[model samples]
Target: MQTNQTYDLLTQVQRIASGDESAFASLFYQFGPRLHSYLTGITKSETAEEELVQNTFIRLAASFPVDRNSKSFRLDLPGGQQ
Candidate 1:
């Protein structure tokens, strides 16, 4: 059974896939900071972290309308394996 938060995220992803800019903004504001922190820890550079996070969202914007048959959504990193 999905929890409220999971359902909410799925709704947001669906909105984002439909080109809902406000939903994009909402998800960004909701997850960006924590994503940044995690990236910063791994890369150890603020510049890289910022770039990475931006690239992430860019990929997200283009790669949505997700595949329902897939058990999970994939976010490919720069020059990284798909």
Candidate 2:
């Protein structure tokens, strides 16, 4: 079951890397609620959670050609810092 879910997520990430808007939307809908809940718990602020979620997706979309080979998630930080 975990393997299947991982494969499916990889597929979605690949599609997203190819600039498929709907794939990105699908991922957003799939994880949005859970991400919101987690963020809310960590930040204890609905507004912050919402903003963080939005920023996260924006970063994901902006980081194209998602590296499937890399085990660690990487988002290019501000000021060109990795």
Assess the local accuracy of residue 23 in candidate 1 as a C-alpha lDDT between 0 and 100. 79
Report clash pairs, candidate 1. Answer: none
Count steric clashes of candidate 1.
0
List model 1 lDDT by residue over 1-82, tens digit each. Answer: 3699999999998876765667777887788888998987699998888788878877776777755654444344333334
RMSD of 1: 7.8
What TM value does model 2 have? 0.73
Locate the minimum summed-lDDT window of 10 residues in model 1. 73-82
Give each model a TM-score: 0.72, 0.73
Candidate 2 achieves a global lDDT of 0.73
- The lDDT for every candidate, in the order shown, is 0.73, 0.73
lDDT of 2 at 12: 90
Cα deviation of 36 in candidate 1 (Å)?
Answer: 0.5
Off by over 4 Å in 1: 66-82
Q: Which lDDT tens digits does candidate 2 get at residues 1-82?
A: 5999999999998877765667777888888788988987799988888788878877777778655564434343232223
